[model samples]
Target: MNHKRSLVRRTAAVAAAGAAALVLAACGGNGDSSAGHDGHTSKSPSASASASQGQHNAADVAFAKGMIPHHRQAVEMADLAPSRAESAEVKKLAEDIKKAQDPEIKTLSGWLTSWGEEVPTEGAMDHSAHGADGGMMTPEEMDQLKNSSGKAFDTAFMEMMIKHHEGAVAMAKTEQADGAYAPAKKMAGAIITSQTAEITQMNKLLGKN
Candidate 1:
């Protein structure tokens, strides 16, 4: 009877050991599964953001580079209206143009910097170098605008601004069609809407509408 009892106790001990080993294996498997789940969750947003930030293409680059200088030129023209322009309406328009384009120029520059592209020099393309490419005024035309005052200044400003806004609208359309970056495309859309309105307003002011 004593030997039989001892054998039973030994069998119980062996069974308990096997059960403990199985429990440990299950816990380890659950821990691994939980870790895998957490890793997948963490990586999903990172991958999405990486894709978004890396999505820009050549059209986006061109949009930024070209628009920066284009905007700068507009701002330059706008700056002259404060002391030089006679019409309150033209002055107000100039103020609005400056307000709109200044921030945009900064944004474009920031994008170029992030993309490892060289930002065009500020005030570099002040003349008509880009006249054929965009509706940029020639040095002589800018001088003529600068030299005029009162109603003459207003007329020249509106006419030149109409042309400039048209050029910007064209560029923005191209960007909307070709740009891969979401923010840039959105900006392009806004440009189209706002600049188109401004062009219409200028034409009306010039009695050309």
Candidate 2:
């Protein structure tokens, strides 16, 4: 009876050991799966952000490089409003343009710097055209604006700024379509919305609406 009882205890101990080993193995398998899932979750966003930051093409570069000077010119034009503008509304509109565009100029510069592209110098901006498509004023046109005052300044400023804002909107649209950087594309969208609104406002200010 003692030997039988001892044999029964030994068998029970072996069974318990087998059960514990199975539990441990199962836990280890689950731990590995959980770790793999966590790794994948962490990597997906990182990979997406990396792609967004690095995937820009020449069009993106052009957009940033071109916009810097464009915004600078707008700010310059806005600066003339305080002294030259006859209407309070025109002055306020100019102030609004400055408020909106100065930061955008800096943002465009930052993007170009991050992309290792050339940041356009103020003196080097192209200014020999006019239209809704990236239009810029010639030196003579800018001088004419500077030389004018009172209602003439207000009218010229409105007309010139309306054209300028249209150009920015065009550039912004191109960036929206082609820019790889998420931040840049977002800025582009913002530019389109704001500039389009400004264009409408300027048109109304000019009595075109």
Cα lDDT computed for each candidate against the true fold: 0.87, 0.84
Candidate 1 off by > 4 Å:
1-48, 51-54, 126-133
lDDT of 2 by residue, 117-178 (tens): 87888777675322347778768889999999999999999899888888888888888888
Which structure among the candidates has the greatest TM-score?
1
In model 1, the clashing pairs are: none
Q: Which digits, one per residue and each the tens of the lDDT, describe model 1 over residues 53-130?
A: 758899999888888888988898998898888889999999999999999999999999988898999766643433
Error of 2 at 10 (Å): 59
My TM-score estimates for the predictions, one after another, are 0.74, 0.72
Residue 90 lDDT, candidate 2, scale 0-100: 90
Best by lDDT: 1
- Deviation in Å, model 2, residue 140 alpha carbon: 0.9
Q: How accurate is candidate 2 locally (lDDT)?
A: 0.84
